[model samples]
Target: MKTETGTPILWTAADAAAATNGRLPARLPAESSRAEWQATGVSIDSRTVQPGDLFVALRGPNFDGHAFVADALAKGAVAALVSAVPAGLPADAPLLLVEDTLAGLEDLGRVARLNFRGKVIAVTGSVGKTGTKEALKQCLEALGPTYATAGSFNNHWGVPLSLARLPADHAFGIFELGMNHAGEIAALTRMVKPDVAIITTVEAVHLEFFANVEGIADAKAEIFEGMTTAGTAVLNRDNPHFGRLLAAARTQGLGQVWSFGRHDQADARLLDCSLHATSSLVTADIRGERVTYTLSLPGQHHVMNSLGVLLCVKAAGGDVAVAARQFSQIQPIKGRGLRKRVPLTKGSLTLIDESYNASPVAMAAAAAVLGKADPGAGGRRIAVLGDMRELGVQSPSLHAGLAEPLRLAGTDLVYCCGPNMKHLFDRLPAALRGRWTESSAELAPLVAAAVRAGDVVMVKGSAGSRMSLVVEALLALDQSSRAGSAVAALSGS
Candidate 1:
């Protein structure tokens, strides 16, 4: 891929101003000596400004980018996009002032999306949005040049920033859109106007903000509000709300609606599935033809999700086999399900890092996968759980209810943290509650001490609970040991 020069290359300043609704300041430099200069890239952070890159001086709630205009200029930024003039910038520096930095970013994203020549796929869900987006990016990239949103950049600011930074000539683009409030998706989707939209599954997430699960469903369905008339909407047939989503798509006048799940009549149906310790072999009836493949990632849920990805690839005008083959390279994202091997004094151990975010639905699924985990030779299944937040008035009962599934899944020991999780801790059979802590930080040491060779440790919690901290603490122990060569001699000849 060609790299964009980090310089202010304006095709037409008038067009830029028009796109942003003429909020630009008059005193700023408008005419340039050269008409065809190169823009290296766009950035919100002035510290990363490169030569010719346009520095977007956005005003954040805490810090103002305008404060860093001098830094951006010193770092070789050719122009600064701002809502207000800063104190230290030179009078001659080019400035594209707008009513708001965030809004300006949206306008720039809209313009970039409109000018691009590639197919765009937008993904959203209560869960699996990031994982599925990563999967689609992996699959789609194999067929042609592809661009995808980096990390979990699927928010109000992230969506626009991703779209604005898109390279003009890329072959394909994938974006993940997320929201917990009404109208949020509508606003973000309007900018991308995706060629294909994938709704992974609607679940009870962000329940604190919603009146009920149906409200969350309505909010998620807003992804179709800005979809192009000819675009396709990929839905999950396994989700109970599939019918509602289907009707929503129809109301939006979407030309195609594809479904994926275990249902026999789904557009992309899972005919059979075999889950192993680290991967799953799946046979699916995709549009009538039976195709079988091995998923590099474990979990039956992932196998079902892959159907959505395959259908989306076809919708995006790419070859299905090309995309399917790319699955071999897909791995779970961190805090989602990325597994690791840690060397302990007793022996090497396996850790399932699902500390990213959790809901009751997802937690149950993770427990099931943990139940089937390969303990190597003598390992036990250890589940380290934290609070699953935002269940509304049913929080306590819902928390306690997890005990049944954990027991059914044959979890050998359960280590729990957080107040809400205490309910589950109390409800568990005394033998199953291995340890409990008021905070994840305090529980980290107990977990490390209890882990044995071949044991599979699954850590999970909602984002608000910060369960990733415990995951980091456990992984860091391995690094500290490695640094001291504590385990090197044990395995040596």
Candidate 2:
């Protein structure tokens, strides 16, 4: 939100001094001393620190951000908020000595929320939280000035950082809260205290931290921990855990419980949804109101989550009709459903990049999208997949379970990577098996070689699997091809 145009004044040096009770440098560094001195931006990573921004030095187990205080100052950071000063820092480096930078960030976030007189929405789930948050951001932006969490900043550190960046004039704020264990969502929700809370869907994700899927559901239900007294809880009724989630919300004294999904009983229900290669046409009944919209993002999962988004728009007193139309403009996010046309010899190759993160439910959903896409005349639908980590002892079964979705998708070839994926590769028919490798880096070349003109390829895996390397390699191949074409054109060939 720290642009030249928008209101980005979260705090100034004087303001931060008052907020944290810290002291400024006795001597001003003449270069940027007169550069407004506003803490217009907040960044933890010194690498991304901008001029005149406040850098919070956060200490972690591996690398302490305080170690980079000098680096941040050199990168044009106007001030530093730190618990401890690093050796060799200049005497003129502006500083805010807080007891703990994490706690300080949370304090600033609370201050931002206290002053924000807008609809605050919190989104969480085992899957689709990023997609839902992004689509909802577009919807709310269409309705009014909106501020949403950047990317999937939905963790212990990310949530507070996002909240602290919120401008006071924002009409809407969307926070994505993610967790891998119990009590994580509870704590984040307490900080968010959303006016509209959305639990996208509870699944067998992060089962390594819980005893069972029900335990995961219980942890997801903790999103209601800090709901506003009159807030609404939006859920996916089609999910089996809907009953339990509803009960939990009711127990929290939430009066308005709107469920969005394929179930006919859902308050915000999908009446009909037609999934296309890169988009979907959806008709839904939202709070007894019938509506239809075209969603630019593919897959039924997005359609279901869009219903929840539209309902949340209405709950937040936004223009549901206008917000619903915004769906058509919502494009796929990078490493989620980002689609690209990679230049090839005969034609162009279609690449669907779901390399950011994955779970069983998400993988099945992506595969379904592949099933629906036409591979064109001579092209084949190829899935370049990798491991879905953190499924606990059920990792093998879960990996093997993807075979059915792949088979049903009519996938012409499958190139899998990672140790857990070996189980899936073993289950695949010989004709369907493209190749298998112990790591994605090793499989990247094989996948690149298998891709042909007009082929549709999808790459997906968890962060641990590093499937993004494959995505990058493919993109680079396309770029090199483009350069070659430019050279040919220059030679009049």
Candidate with the greatest lDDT versus the true structure? 2
Once fitted onto the true fold, the runs of candidate 2 whose alpha carbons sit more than 4 angstroms away are: 1-6, 21-36, 483-493
Expressed as tens digits, the lDDT of each residue in 284-370 for candidate 1 is 877765777788988877888999999998889988877787887788888999999988655778889999889998898899889
Point out where model 1 deviates above 4 Å: 1-18, 21-37, 46-52, 75-78, 483-493
The best candidate by TM-score is 2
Residue 309 lDDT (model 1)? 92
Model 2 Cα lDDT, one tens digit per residue, 104-209: 8887787778878999999999999988898889999988889999988899999988988888888999999999989999999888889999999999999899
TM-score of 1: 0.91
**Candidate 1 clash pair list:** 5-40, 6-40, 6-51, 6-52, 6-53, 7-40, 7-52, 9-37
